[model samples]
Target: MIDSSAFQGKKAIYYTLGCKLNFSETSTFGKMLADMGVVTAEKGERADICLINTCSVTEVADHKCRQAIHKMAREHPGAFIIVTGCYAQLETEKVSKIAGVDLVLGSNEKADLIQYLNDAFIHRAEGTTLHAFHAVKTKDIKRFQPSCSKGNRTRYFLKVQDGCNYFCTYCTIPYARGLSRSPSIASLVAQAEEAAAEGGKEIVLTGVNIGDFGTTTHERFIDLVKALDGVEGIKRFRISSLEPDLIDDELIEYCAGSRAFMPHFHIPLQSGSDMVLKLMHRRYDSALFARKIALIKRLMPDAFIGVDVMVGSRGERPEFFEACYRFLDGLPVTQLHVFPYSERPGTSALTIPYVVDEKEKKLRSKRLLAMSEEKTHAFYEQYIGTERPVLFEKAHRGKAMHGFTDNYIRVELPPSLARDAYDNEIMSIRLGGFNHDGTALKAELT
Candidate 1:
């Protein structure tokens, strides 16, 4: 047993890198520390503890995590630095060996953070030089730890699920996060209710494989969507990235007419080429994906559809790249989240004969990104004269405030009209042309 008094008046700082799921978990960890009387360290003040949540989706992500670990150690000398998340889980030994990491906790060990902190403090005091480490030898995704982020941000992230079951080639998420699992729909609904009661107007449902919800609970993803739709006080809800195959007609129909669900969808179609998708071991083909997009647009024509496309993967010859480019050109997506495929160790993709070189990978990625920009610009241009409701987020007094429309269009209010009073309020606005930078649409109060 540890004495709670030892943690009183401790100051801690948190840094998060990667997806919204990591942000949600970091908030939960901060809350856990707060309950133990740990307050956030003031700006420029040295904290007694440092917590880093990392991501390892790609080789570049791994390099960034290492740089972050070193930077945190240098800035806050002697602070009890702790590292966790996908990067820490997958590369436990390497993270533990980092100069300033005092403890390396795996994905499953994060729930018991306080106890680990106590152990770390005691060991450090006893002149133990070695870093403390705790992780499962064989990953277990069975445990479902519910987390909701209620930080200073305008939108709250509700983590309804964790882990991934789809072991796609060229991916290490399964090895890092374990298999697919999620909490009961009833529990997630209760969490959304609590967030609403706390004045959260927007909540983004986050998960490793959200469409695979109820892998453990045996409830369907559509059923979870129906339950959350009934939660009052939440003005907007957005579903995160989901697999193309799991998106059924029932769910699309519900969101089309639902009270709170937004007219936004982020679907991952890693490759537009059917052959490349087969090589990647993705469940759905290009035809099935195209059908889903068509259905969503038919029901919600003004919907904002975002796609995830990976370029230069194994077996993606020049002809396949051209095929993917042509296929995407025909789609009506609003945006594309593009990235070059990185080789992850211990994956089946390494066995494939053909591999894309660095220069070719860069060229392929550039072509796809250029195409994505054109589509996004065209999508924004179509809604220039329309009216939509935008929920403005909090911003500094002198800075321009921004918000997202129901269809996920980013609208900016000029600095003159950006008042503290308008923060966190939804209002009707006439959408205008792109602002000075063409980054977002300009808007004015109706």
Candidate 2:
């Protein structure tokens, strides 16, 4: 329980990194602060507290977490700094040693922030002390932490599931997030209704592995989707990301004809080579991944598909790299999220042979990024001279406004449309020629 008067006039600012789940969790903390009468700090305003939600999936992400902590501390010298999320969960002692972090919470303890902060404030007023570090074992992160983003009304990331069961060799997510688990379907629906009430137009279902839903209960991911599609007020629900093996024809067919589900999918295909898949301990092979995309395209040709790829992991010789390149060259994917592999401490991938050098990793990353741009351009070219519903997210960004269609194409509107009336509102836009820089599609009001 919160005494609203405690925070009646204070302000808190938040900085988030990593996945949709992290953003959703941060929003939950923000909502708790709001209930306690703490408002989010306005632009260029000072805040009493600064919260940083972090990620440690890759070496780059870990570096970013550390940088953000130090940056926030330096920028707001007097603010009470709190750091939580994957990096904090994995490197609790390291984060606690950072110069201005007052408190560090593990993944499991993040949801208990309201209680922890309340105690800290009480001790502060009474001239007592509070612990700076509060972290539990990863195994204790068993329960689901329900979170929904309220900062953005166009699309609220609704975390229905948490943790991961598959401990892939090159991955630290399982160690950082704990085991796979989910809340009941009924519970998710209640949360979705609340988000809709908060002016959320779309709900992006996010998790460590959303397709692995219902492991605790008897329900399935399909069951959850069917229920959410029928919810009133929400314009659509988007599957943030999912595994290839978990996506079946049944789920694809349901989404194809659903009234609320969008036509977009982001499946991680780390390496196209089957040998690399085995080395990484991935569940499905390249053939199954291609088949899944084919099925989705057959059902909905206009569907946008994004794939995650790791450019340079262990056990990738020249031939294996060629196999991966060939596989991706043949696929009909719309976009690629290219990542260069970096070994994590205590992961099985460190023992794998043929470690790729950083130089080669950069080269491979550049190649894949070029491929991605070409694929994205081709995907957008098809929609030229077509009209689609564009949900304008930011109506004022320098000189132009930006929005996205149902299939996830970035549409840029002229300065004339840069009005508060179009912000967070869905409207029909006509796709015109490709921009001068070939970055985004030029769109006009239809």
Q: Pick the candidate with the highest TM-score.
A: 1
Worst 10 residues of 1 by lDDT: 137-146
lDDT of 1 by residue, 1-446 (tens): 97677789989999998999999999989988999999999899999999999999998999999998898899999899999999998889889999989899888888888998987777766888547777775356456667987666889999988888889998988888888888888889999999988888899999998999988889999998889989999989999888998999999999999999999999999999999999999999999999999999999999999999999999999899889999999999999999899999999999999989999999988888888889889989999988999999888878889999999999999888888877778899899999988888999788
Which one is best on lDDT?
1
Residue 46 displacement in candidate 1 (angstroms):
0.6
Candidate 2 residues 1-446, lDDT tens each?
75556667888999999988888888888988888888888878888889999999888899999899888888787777889999999999889899888889987888888777777777777987565887778777776788877564467888988889999999989878889999999999998999888777888999999999998877899999999998898997899999999999999999999998999999999999999999999999999999999999999899999999998899987788889998998999999999999889989999997888999999999988999999999999999999999888765455788778999999888786677778778888899978778877998776
Candidate 1 residue spans exceeding 4 A from truth: 124-130
Model 2 spans with C-alpha error above 4 angstroms: 1-3, 129-131
| TM-score of each predicted structure versus truth | 0.98, 0.97
